[model samples]
Every structure is written in structure tokens, then in C-alpha cells.
Target chain A: MIGVISYQTGNARSVLRALAAIGAPARLVASPDDCDDIDRFVLPGVGAADVTMKSLEEAGWPDYLRARVVEGGAPFLGVCVGLQVLLDHSAEGDVDGLGWLSGEVREFPSSELRVPQMGWNSVDVKSTHPLLAGVPSDSYFYFVNSYFATVGDDDLLATTEYGAPFAAVIGRDNIMATQFHVEKSGPAGLAVLTNFVNFGKAA
Target chain B: MLTTRLIACLDVVEGNVTKARRFEDNIVVGDVETVVAGLYQQQIDEVIFYDILASAQNRRIDLETVERVASRVFIPLTVGGGIKSLEDMHLVLDAGAEKISMDSMAVKNPELITQGANEFGRQCIVVSMQVKRVVPTAAIPSGYEVAINGARVFTGMDAVEWARKAEAMGAGEIVVNSIDQDGTHQGYDLTITKAITDAVRVPVIASGGAGTVAHIAAAVQEADVSAAIVSSILYSPRMEKLTTVAELKAELAHDYGIHVRPIVAA
Candidate 1:
């Protein structure tokens, strides 16, 4: 079973539903025991970073996750703030992040575009990965974010342009993350979840 | 690029879509699933279900209908009507709605907007506004006024001003509709729409006056809105049985040079 991190971030339901729709039924992993035997992991987050990180800590996830996802080499997927918490820090809550990946989450550059950059925008693939397999290049994915991760090109999997090019999808090794909401995106989104789930199963 | 969205709205009354069918005779009973699913097949960008009388009748959003419609379609669903508190918001979001919009209740207690955003994130909270054209009074120098409680209570507040306030309250997007041009088929009130769209930093959707493919195009080009709500015109027989979301997208592309999601052919 896929271990979906349960917290106050409010994204678990959609992610859980998407997992089921893609035939990857998951269990809500609120404690360390929940993650011990799970084959893979899905970290879903929404709302503020500090709140999410606090929730994660309250559920005793940071240390457990470090061992399970990083050391154990289990496949993982992070959505929205789920993707943000992988960074070293964020301007939103002015708090530290999970630091799983080397990066900093910063607010989008103020421009003609709206702050949230909310809408269906195309993601240009930068590197080929299992999670992106079967998903057409430049296919539109739903986005609703005011800040995006500023990560090294080494970990960036895909990029989307709103005011400026920012990391739309990121992954290195068994850890994968997306700045957009996959469940709300429609068919293109389902294809993404399918690829991620299948890739983990194969591994 | 964030292409314009074409949204299909379902007007549900007294917790029953069937009951409202008499007044809105164009809508068929038990067609919530069929209509929304059919629209989904045509690749409609988003679907919104409005619990028409939930507020007036002192009830809540039709969660049963919302759940039924949501189950039949995969695209994003937004539900509005009588969303009086955070619990009501949770009820609909749990029912599979991606976003929850508030109008009357939002005006009644502005804190609801901030609270909803704080708990669910700004993306999940959409503040819907209805604007009426009025004389250029000093308070609302823009000449467009805000109306609450189904347009029965005019707040003397400017539409543009109210939109800014809602956005400040952490609303992610604004659905600014026209009361003057509503159902007039003369297209959205471009003056107010453009005013609000230009003033806000968030995405704004022009609602309540799309009568033709051209009108939808005008909403995009003139008001510079991110989306437009199409209802009455789509239900008319001229629209080929109200399954014209794809057709509207096609017409916008071929005639007006605006493109949306490619139609998912049935």
C-alpha cells in the first residue's frame, strides 16, 4: 500500500482519491508504524508551509520520512505544498523545510501575472522520467501557487512559465514532487499519477 | 499559458435540481449527472453547481447533488450557495468539489473569506460577486454597485472596491458577474468587468450574460477575464441541446482567435 501522509494540510483526500482512481490504493500514514511496511509514499500538502511542517512534526513524520524515503529508497510523490516542504526554507511561513532536496521556496516574481498564477498552464519537460512517461510534452496541467521552488537544474524535471520559468516538477532518485495539483487537473493529471504509481510498483 | 476557461453551471433549488426545473424549464430533472457528464465529454474546463435557494431558504448546499454530479465527471467542480460557515465549506469540499465559492454568506461575515483561505488554502476559496450598474455616486464613483442576498440588498459598495477587499481577505480568484447585463444576452457588462479585472491581481471570471460564441470571445478580449460562465444561451434549442461547450471553444478559435482546451470528442 502507498503511504499517504495525513496532516492538517487538507490535500490528502484528493490525492487518496486520485491514487484509488489510478488503481494504487493507499493507507493514511499518520505515524511511523503506518510507513514501515508501505511500498511507496505520497506526501500531499496545501495551505501554509509552517502549519504543514508543524503538522508533520506533530505526527512524528520528519525523522521517519527521512529514513523511509531517503535511506530506504522507497518511491515518493509530493503535491503542491507537499513539493514546497522538500526545500530548505520558504518565505511564506519564514520557517525551515524538510530539506530532503537542496532548494529554497520563493514567491513568484511580481509581474503582469496574478500572484497565485492560477489556471491551466503547460509544463515543458526538461528531463525524461517515469512519472512523466506517456504525458505529452507541453501538455497543460493545473497550477495554483504564489511561490515555487528554486532548485538546481540537477533535480528539476519540468518547468512552466507564468511570470518567469519556475520548477513545475522536480525529482531526483526515488523522490518526486509537483508544484501543481494533479488531482484537480483532469486527464493529463490522471496520466501523471498513473505513471508515478506504476513506476514505483515496477521498482 | 493559462487559457480561458468555459464553465458549466448547474442551478439546484430546494436540494432538488428537479424542483427548480419548472422555473428553469430549460433544465431537465435528474439530468444533473447527464448534463454535467455530457458537458464533461465535450471537454468543458470547469463545472459549477449553484444551490439557488440554499441561502433564501436557510439551508445548506445540496451536497447530495454536488456529490452525484462530481462522481459523474473528472474535471474540477465548484459549489456555491448557502455556504454559511467553514463546516459547510468542508462538507462540499469533502463531496469532491475542488473549490467552494461564497456570495451572500461572504458579505454577511467577511471573516469567512479569510478563515476559509487559511484552512483550505487560497486556491479553494473563490469569492463570487454580483454587481449592479448605478449612477456614478461619490461612494461608488465607478458607477457599479455591489448587491448581496440575490441582488435584493444593495450595499452601495463599489464592485471594484469589494473585489479588492475580497482579494485582500485572501481570496484566490474572483467571479465578478453583472446584474445589469445578466440574461440580457448583450454580453457581460464590459465596463464593470474590465474595471474589476484590471484592478485585481487574481484571476477574474465574467459571469451572467453569455448569449453566443461571440459573447464568450468578447469576455476574453474586452474584459480580459480568465474565464466566462455560459448558461441560458447554452440551454436554448439553438445550441443543439445545450451540449455546446466544445462548439463554443471551436467557434472562439476559428472566429475570434482565442483557443481553450481541445474538445474531448464523444
Candidate 2:
């Protein structure tokens, strides 16, 4: 079964609904014990980075999730703040993130563009991966975040531009994440989640 | 590049979808669920569920309707009308709404905008203004003032100035509706829409007076708003030809050389 990690975030319901729409067996993972026997995991969040991290730590997610993704090499996906928390730090909450990926989350530098780049922007792929299968290049995805992740060139999967370029999608090894909300991104986004479900299930 | 959005505003009363002209002459179109599903089938870009009587009647927003309609909608769904406090915003967002819009409440208590933004991110708060044209005054130099209580009371707040304040107060987006042009079917008030759109950095949505496909196209190209909130143009059966969001998107791409996401038939 697919496990969705929901630790006091708002997007969990929409994420699960999207999964159900695609006929995938998924359940919310709210505790350490809920992380057991998961074929793949989705960490869905729509809250601030600091608050999400605190909630995850309070629920013993920092330790449990690291073991699941890093040590076990399980296929994993993160959405919005879920993707932000994978970095080393975020300017939003002034809190340290899970640091599973090597980077910091910073605010967009362009004052001309509005903060919380709220709308649909086109995603331009930088490199290819199994998780990106069927996701059309230049396809628009809905985004509602102020900070964008900063990582090495090798980890960037796709980038989108508002006034400046920001990482829209990222992947490294078994870890996959998107800065946009795939749950609300319509058909194109549904295809991304379908690929994630079937990515490593071949094992 | 981000494309212009076509949003459908469903003014619901009791439990059915309805439409009003200049905030009066209410008429029911269909059940909220059925109308919303039909939009989803045709692939409207976004939707707003405004409880028409909730603010005037002084009652809580209808959460059951929000939950029911939201279940059938896949795109971003925003809820408005009678959202007086953070608790009301919570109820709507928890009911599967992506954003919560405040009309009269935002003017009466502007702090709600900051509070809502701080607690639930700025992107969750939408400030919708109903504007009416008037003489230029010190309070409103733009000659367009804000009206509340369904256009029953006019506040001497300039539409352009108020939009700037709403953005500073943490409104992620602004919806500027023209009272004079509402339900007229002539076209959108491009003057007021352009004034507000040019004055703010955030996305602006123009509402009121959409007669035909050309009107919507003009709002997007001339006014340069991020989106247009249309109602009667799509609902009124008296129009020469019925228009769907699918047809609108296709026509936009063909006429103006704009590209919107394609929607498939359900």
C-alpha cells in the first residue's frame, strides 16, 4: 500500500483524494508506527516549513522518515513544504529542515514578482528520470509558495520561471519532489503521481 | 508563461446555484453540484462559491454546500461571503476550499486579512471588492468607490487605493467587480480594471459586464488582468449562443494567440 505522511499539514486530504482518483491504494501516515510496510511514501504539506518540521519532530518523523528514505532507499515524494523540508534550512520559518537533500530554501529575489508565486507556471525539464515519465515539457503546474529550494545542478529535475528561475521539480536517487501542488494540477499532475506509484513497485 | 484564467463565480443561495443583476433580481440556474460538475466536465480553470445571502442575513457560511461542491471540483476552489473571522476561514478551508475570499468583512475589519495571511499563508486570503463609479473625492480620487452589503452601502474608498492596501495587508489576490457594469452585458469596465491592475503587484480578477466571447478576450488583452470572473455570459440562456469554458479556451488560443491548458471530456 502507498503511505502518505500527514503531520499537521493541510494538503493531505487533497493528496489522498488525487491518489484515490488514480485508483492507488493509499492511507495517511500520522505516526511512527504508520510508516511500517510502505511500498512508497508521499510527504504532503501545505504549512510553513518551521511548523511542519516541529510537527514532524513532535511526532518522531525526522528520525523515522530518514530511516525509511535514506537508509532503506524507499521511493519517496514530497510536495510544497514537503519539498521545502527536504532542504537544510528555510527563510520562511527560520528553522532547520530534515536536511535529507543538500540545500537551503530561500525567498524569490525579484520584488517585481509577487511573493507566494500563486498560479500556474510552465515546468521546463532539466533532466530526465523515471518519475517524470509522461509529464509533458512546458506543462503548467499550480504553485503556491514563497520560498524555492536551492540545490546542486545534479539534483534539479525541472525549473520554472516567474521573474527568475526556481527549481520546480527535483530528484536524487530514490527521492522525488515537486515544488508545485500535484494534487490540484489536473491531468498533467495526476500523471506524475501515477509514475511515482509505479516507479519502484517493480521490485 | 502563465496564461489568462477564466473563472466561474457561482452565487449560491439556500442550496441552489443563482445569479443576480446589480445585486438584485435573483434567479436560480440549477443545483450547485450539477452546475459545478458540468463546469468541471467542460474544464473551467477555477471556481468561486459565494453565499449570496449569508452576509446580508448575518449567518454562518454554508459549509455543507462547500464540501458537497468541492468534492466534485478538481481545480482550485475558492469560497467567499460571510467569512467574518479566522474560524470561518478555517471551516471553509477545512471543507476542501483552496482559498477564502472576504468582501464586507475585509473592509470592516482589515486585520482579518493580516491574521488570515499569517495563519494560513497570504495565498489563502482573497479580498473581493465591489466598486461603483462616482465623482472624484479626497477619499476616492479614482472616481470609483467601494460598496458593501451587496452594494447597499458605499464606502468612500478608492478602488485602486484599496487594492494597494489589501495587498499590503496580505491579500494574495484581488477581485474588482464593477457595480454599474454588472449584468449589463455590455462588457467589463476596462477603465477601472486597468486602474486597479496597474496599481497592484498581485494578480487582479475583473468581474462584471461580460456579454460575449469578445468581451472576455478584451478583458484579458486590454485590461491585462490575470483572470476574468464571468457569470451571466455562461449561464443566461438568452444569449445568441451558449458558451462553455472548453469553447472559450479554444477560441482564445485561435483568436488572440494565447495558450490555456487543454481540458478533456469526462
Candidate 3:
């Protein structure tokens, strides 16, 4: 069973729909107890960092998720703001993140390019990670954010350019993340989600 | 580089794509997913879903439609049409809408824009204004009166002044729709379009009166607007408007030295 983290942010329902579209049954888990029966976990968010963390804390998801990913060794995936919370810290909020990865989230500095980087853009696939198994290089993905993660380690799987090229996809061990909305990114996006589900099933 | 956006407007009602104009005639478009999939195939830059009768019902956005479109389209989706409060805005955004365009609610309570901006950031909020040209009366001068909920509220506010105020309240962009010229197929109300564009610093989307490719080109060049939003031209097969945005942009560049970015399909 696949479990999606329920917070105040958007994209959870679409993620659930995408999972179901690919013949996978997923449940929306708002609490740690709700995640007990699920085998795989997905974190989906849309808003700022501080508020998202607050929602997670208020709903008692931090403790539950920490136990699920760290102790239970469940396969996990994060999308957009969900990806930001996996970092050590986020510029969007004062609170520290779950710190699943050694990185800090920072805003994409305003320049000639539009803020929020809204629309479909090309992604340059870097590594041979399972999340990007059959995904082509220079494939386009949908992105809508003002901030992204900058990690020290070389777990970056894909990079996309707006004003500047930033890490669009990151993965380490059982935990993976995409700054773009895979549930929204057409056929290529479905391919990435299918790959993630396959990776979870294989594990 | 600033790109010309090709936006697909989804007229939604009761969680479905309710109605659209084809040859100036109302036709029932399919569900949000099917329509969005067709628009995605066209490689449109962005998609806007307007709830025609949502505000009158005093409800939030259609979240079910947002989820359906978000799962299908891989582009920026702006959901509008009954967004009245911050909580309403949150409902749409949480359902995968990239931006929320407030109409009647923002006009009634300007603080909604401020509060929404403070909470979700300005980029997530868009103030949609319906401008109707009104002759100068004893009480009002040569200005446009803003309407909400399908000409429900005739807020004696000047359209240009409202654009400026909305900008001051932290609107990331402004969508100016001319009610008088809507579905006319003649052209956009350039006078009003130019007024709103010059009044605000943010990008202005010229909507409501795009009949042909020439009208779209004229709106972009003469009005100096960032985007020319056309519904009938693209959706109506009987209309001879260009199908691809690249073709239209090229025509505009060739005709008027105005460089417009073409929306490429994924």
C-alpha cells in the first residue's frame, strides 16, 4: 500500500489520483497511525516552508514520518515543497526541516526571468537513478516555485534552467524528490511516477 | 526573455468544464481533464479556469476540477471564479492550482488581496478585473466600471485606478477583461487595455475581445499588453485564427516588429 502525507499544501489528491491511474492503491495519511498499514510513503506540498512544517507538526506527521522513513525504512518521494522539507533548512521559514538530506532551501533570486518559474521547462537528466530510469535527457517538466534546495552532496539526478540551472530532481537511498510536479508533467511525469512506484515495489 | 503566454481558459461549473464559445455559440466542453489534455497538446503556456457562476453560490473554487487538470496538464494552471477568502484560495492551491485569480471578492474586500499576498506570496494571487466602458455621467467621469460575478456588481470604481490599487495591494499580475467587446470578434478595447497596462507595473493580460489573429496581434502591439487571451479564436474551428501559438507569434513579428515568444508543446 502507498501512503501520501496529508498537509495543508496542494497536490496530494493529484498524487493519489496518479497512483491510482497507474494501478496502485494509495491512502491519504494525515497521522502516524494512519501510515501504519501503508508500505510506501509520498510527501506532497505546495505552500511556503514554515507553514508546511507547522501543518505537519500540528497534524503530528513529523514524528510519524520520522519513524516511518528512518526506522521502518519505507521508500519515500517528495514533490515541490515536499522536496524542500526534506532538506536541513528552508529559507521560506524559520523552522528547520526534517533534515532527511544535508541541504538548505533558498529562494531563486529575482532576475530578468519571471519569479515562481511557472510553466513547462526542460530538465537535463544527470544520473542513472531509478527515479529517472527511462526518462529522456532534456525532457520537460512542470515547475512552480520561488525556492529550491541546494545540497552539498552529488545526489542531484536532474537539473533544469530558468534564470539559472537548478537541481530539479534529487535522490539518495530510499528517499527521492522532484522540484517539479510529476503528477502534472504529462507523459514524462507519469513515467517518473511509474518508475518510483516500481522502485518501491522492487524494494 | 519574456515569453508570450498562450493561456487556455476553462469555464468550469459544478466541477466540470461547463461552457465555452465556439463560433460565438455556447457549447458544452468536456470535463476539465479532457479539455486540459487538448490544450496541453496545443502546448499552451498557461491555463486559466474561470467559474462563471461560482461566486453567486458563495463557494470556493472547484477543487475536483483542479485535481483533474493538475494530474493531466504539465503547465501553470490559474484557477479563478468564486475565490472569496484566503481559505478559498488555499483550497485551490492545495488542489494543485499554481495561481488563484480573485474577482468579486477582491473588489469587495481589498484586504483579501493583501492577506493572500502575505500568506501565499504575490505570485500566487491574480486580480481579475472586468472593465466596461461607461460614458461620463454627473457622478462618474470617462472611466470604466468594474464588474464581478458576470456583471453582478457595478462597483463605480475606475478600471485603471483599480488596477493601480490592486498592484499596490500586492497582485503579481492583472487580467483585464473588456465586457463591452467580449465575444464581439471586432477587437479588444485598446483604450481600456492600454489604460490598465500603463497604470500597473505587473504584466497585464488582455482578454474579452479577440476575434481573429489580427485582433490578437493588435492587442499585443497597440495595447502594449503582455498576453492576449483569446477563447473563441482557438476553440472555434470555424474561425480562421491560427492554431499554433508559434505561427501567430511569427505573424506578429513579421507584421509589426513585435517579438512574441511561442508556446512549445512538450
The most accurate candidate by TM-score is 2
Between candidates 1 and 3, the DockQ winner: 1
Point out where model 2 deviates above 4 Å: A33-39, B263-266
Instruction: State the lDDT of candidate 1 residue by residue for A81-180, as single tens digits.
Output: 8999998999888989999898998887656677777777888898888889867767887887888887999999999887778889999978999988
Model 2: per-residue lDDT, tens digit, A1-203?
88888765456767887898899999887887866667788988775788788888898988877887889888899998899999888998798998888888987753576566777778888887887886777887888877888788999998888777888898897999999888877777788999888887664
Q: List the residue pairs that clash in candidate 3.
A: A10-B94
Ranking by TM-score, best first?
2, 1, 3
Local error of candidate 1 at residue B178 (angstroms): 1.3
For candidate 3, give the lDDT of residue A22: 76
Question: Which candidate wins on lDDT?
Answer: 2
Per-prediction DockQ, in order? 0.57, 0.50, 0.22
What would the per-residue lDDT of candidate 3 be over residues B133-186, giving only the tens digit for each residue? 898664445478888667646888878878889989988778888888776667
Residue runs of model 3 more than 4 Å from their true location after superposition: A70-72, A111-113, A200-203, B1-4, B13-34, B41-45, B57-76, B90-98, B117-123, B132-145, B151-154, B158-161, B167-172, B186-204, B211-228, B237-266
Residue B173 CA displacement from its true place in model 2, Å: 0.6
TM-score per candidate for chain A alone = 0.94, 0.95, 0.94
- Can you give the lDDT of residue A136 in candidate 2? 70
What are the per-model numbers of colliding residue pairs? 0, 0, 1
Per residue, candidate 1 scores C-alpha lDDT tens digits across B1-266 of: 66788887667664433322112333444457776776677777888888878888898777887877765566778899999888888888877788889987888899999999998888789999988889998899899998987777889888889999999998988998787766656688888889988888888888877778888888899989888988766653333344367678888888998857666433
- Badly placed stretches (over 4 Å) of model 1 are B14-30, B236-243, B264-266
| TM-score of model 2's chain A | 0.95
